[model samples]
Target: MRADRLMTIMILLQNRGKMTAKELAEELEVSDRTILRDMDALSTAGIPVVSDRGKDGGWRLVDNFRSQLSGLTMDDLKSLFLFPSGKVLEDLGLHSGALDTRQKLLAAIPGTFRGEAEAIWERIHIDSSTWRASKENLDALKTVQQAVWESKKLTILYEQADGEQNERVVEPLGLVAKGDTWYLVAIRDSEFRNYRVSRIHKAIVENETFIRPANFILAGYWEQSKEEFIQRLPAYDVQVEIHPSVMKRLYFTSKFVQVIKKESSSPDQWIEATLRFNAEQEAVEYIVGFANKMKIIAPKDLKSKVVSLANSVIDFYNEL
Candidate 1:
């Protein structure tokens, strides 16, 4: 752990030029005394760590000193290329920036490791889009992105969960891309909110800009919001019995179905499992798609709704 902290300190000083003991402690989630101890250890290890006193005093690496990132192994190089979050940059229309940064990284690495890193890109690829994912209509994406980067306010036509459209003027904070979906984190009425980029029909950047709060970390805020959103979502547990033939399909294909406890001992028979869904309607719609291959064992209301839909489907087909 101390080794990792020392490496982190070096990297931080290398990149940031200088940072106080308090700042380093805060950044590393350690105490100022621990930071001072780490600094002493770094100096003892022949790493030139310059320190000074007073308000402008902090820790910094000696100028022109380079680390051994160039000596990374083939696996390490491959790990660097295997970034699923690169999709986020692509969604934000920063694909060129991502590519340019990769190229620069390749140049920085030693020639021996560079070939292996470049090969990783060719051997592995990440497909972040879901099955049958629809094209996102983001006409306002550029306008919203501009607002986020420039710290400008924006007036937007946003579609709500109930499909009602409302005009909102907001201070854009950050943009988060989860797979193909994009969400704009913003401030309005002194409250933070998330707006789906696809739901934004129109966006006009306002001339006025606001000061971004110093302590607001975008990544941290997004994580907290994600947890809160998940907790707030309406979730219902469903008991289902699946035929062995479709059992694997249910487990692999459905995000709604999380196997709680498998009740089947044999491989060829019906397997009882529990699933979850955001709403009864959603559960009904998804289960109805499987036709006769699946059955809802409990939650009689959901079973009834699925039965009603299946009968309707049969009636329409019989009429033809």
Candidate 2:
């Protein structure tokens, strides 16, 4: 571990030029004293580490010395070649560039590890889109991307989930791709918000540039926002008995349903399970789709609704 830390220190100093002991310690999750000790060790090993004092002082390598300590492990090589979805790259106009980069990386790595890296690309593949392949309209993505890159304000016509259109002027901060969908993280009316790129019907980049917030980190903000959004979702729980034959089907339909618990049963016997949905209507609709394969055990009102809906479907078909 100490050897790894020493190598990391050398790489950090080589790349960042100068970093204070406190900064290095915070980054490496160590103590300031530990960082100072590491610096002394590096100097003793004739690494040419020089430390200066005062407010603008830190540790740096002397005479523009570059270390040849950079190396990639097998896992690192695999991670570099684990490409994201091709459609996502095309959406960002990076598909061709990504292909070129992949070729260059294959040629640049050490020849000893080349065969394993090539095998990784051939054996493993990632498909991030849903099975249904819901198409998204991202015509405004290029404009939004440009605004984010230039730190420019934008005038946008955004359509809400309820089909209401509203025009707003926002300061573009960053773009995030969750699954196959893209969202623009921006500041509107001095508050941070995420706008679905598909819902952006129109976008006009403005000439005025806004100063980005110093404390805002794109990835950090997205993670916090995602967690908060999940916490705010409504939940409706239900108990049911599902036929053993359809057990695998239940697990496959997880986009709208979550299995909370399952009671043990014989292979041919019905399995008692608890499931959760976003609302009572959704639960009823989902349960009824399984036909006679599932039976609701609790919430008498939900069972009645499901029965009524199923009968209505039958009566309509009979009339037809």
Candidate 3:
């Protein structure tokens, strides 16, 4: 552990040129005495660590000192160019630094791999936002980001689906940006829950702090939650007879429906297919779009609803 601290101190001195013992201690979450000992260790190990004593004095690496990461290969250098989505970076207030960080990384690569590594940027770009997604109001984003970084608790006013407002004090863990939307994953009452960033009417960083769970990984936990949520959803199957021409339009018509099985009765004229929906009303609404091009084959109740809805539409159109 001390070896790691010594190496980290050396790297910091090399990059920062100069830093006070107190500053290093704060950055490493240690005491000033430990930092002084680490400095002595680095100097004893043949590193040129210069320490000054005065009003404007601190530790610094001797002039002409250069320490580069020798283990980096061409692929490693290229991977450094990979960055998160721009919207996410902007929310975290790192958009400006992202570009500067990439360029500085390019300058750090050895000449042998520099050209090939820089070519990655010229060839690749990542766009995570969906086309024409409405921009979310992220006024609370910066406050929530700071809380996550500082491991501070947050008292937030959240809007619920029933139009009721609830205030919760959550331990801010991580943020996930999908398309133009942001989801705040946090711990409340010792349970992990997700809150939409846009739905947060107010966010106040509390003075309290929370010990982050040692094994709670943001990416892994979010994925597991998604899988569990999907598994818990009730799925119903619908049997339908669809004309061959109408099947192509089914894909774009419903987001919740998908064909599970198909049987060809007349060898390409009509297809009997089983589709999945979350509810019976969903099935009825989707079936109504096809009109006479499709017919319900089973679930007599759903068929009756479709007929009733169709007749209602006919009556409404007749009055016009």
Candidate 4:
């Protein structure tokens, strides 16, 4: 990167008190003339660096010259370290600032709980693969989250997969972020609709805000939605001859009906597990994900559907 040497110089100066031109050149593997030129550029940029001539001479940024980023508590800094921002701030080719900001951030925090913080940092990693990217709509997201907190009306443009876009005034209800994807559960036309943040092209905060009803919550609505789905979809009881050795693990998941039982002592380590799904298609799709691990026993339709899906996937990949 064009500024690689310059950044190196800045970091070194930030860490070490001061250094002579020769030291900078040797540390950065560059000639004295190159270092001198960089120092000129750096000085011109008002980098709070001073050079002394006679004996006690070297270039140095005024000690603690950089202002602290204030108000962030130790916990806050640690949290940021544990979960760095998703976006790449600058292209490495352009700015190439190394010394991960996260490391510097952690270093600045008080050392009292640094050990605990380190443990937490190692254990807790945010996949945020589902969090909406870009600051493009952050103000809107914050406004909507606030509205959800306050039960206020929000105007937003929602885009469908088919490329259709519609602008509507709706009430913000709650939010859920799955992986990096964020969803806003809101009331539209007296009905709850899940709006994917990425699909929302625009949001306008209305003059009106609201106080959210104490009775409302997104999770409660979601649980109700699951129950409703079960009622809506055709109920189909399924018994699968799952591999016996996995019975304990299968029971732990409880992905199936509570009515689980082993059919017989099998020569092969396998067990018969009974589960139920609202829709045959759903069950079929579910089992297909674990193709070799599961075998549908009683319901021929589920097995056939799984097989059909597998065949279709195989055919598609084979053609590719």
After TM-score superposition, what is the CA distance of residue 209 in candidate 4 from its true location, in Å?
Answer: 4.8
Error of 4 at 87 (Å): 5.8
lDDT head-to-head 2 vs 4, winner: 2
Q: lDDT per model, in order?
A: 0.81, 0.87, 0.83, 0.68
lDDT of 1 by residue, 213-281 (tens): 889999999999999988898877788887788765776675765566668658877778788887787
- Enumerate clash totals for all models, in the order shown: 0, 0, 0, 13
Pairs of residues clashing in candidate 1: none
Ranking by lDDT: 2, 3, 1, 4
- Model 2 lDDT tens row, 1-320: 77767767776776567999998998889999999999888988899999989999998889656643258799998898998888778888875621245555664566567688889988998887767775899999999999999999999999999999999999999999898999999999889999999999999999999999998999999999999999899999999999999999997865889998999989999999999999999998899889999999888678899989999999999999
Residue 32's lDDT within candidate 4 is 91
Model 2 ranges with Cα > 4 A deviation? 1-71, 97-99, 110-112
lDDT by residue for model 3 over 70-137, one digit each (tens)? 88976686678877677667767775721256655654555466577768878877888776766677
Instruction: Report how far residue 51 has shifted in candidate 1, in Å.
Output: 39
Q: How much lDDT does candidate 2 score?
A: 0.87
Best by TM-score: 2
Tell me which of candidates 2 and 3 scores higher on lDDT: 2
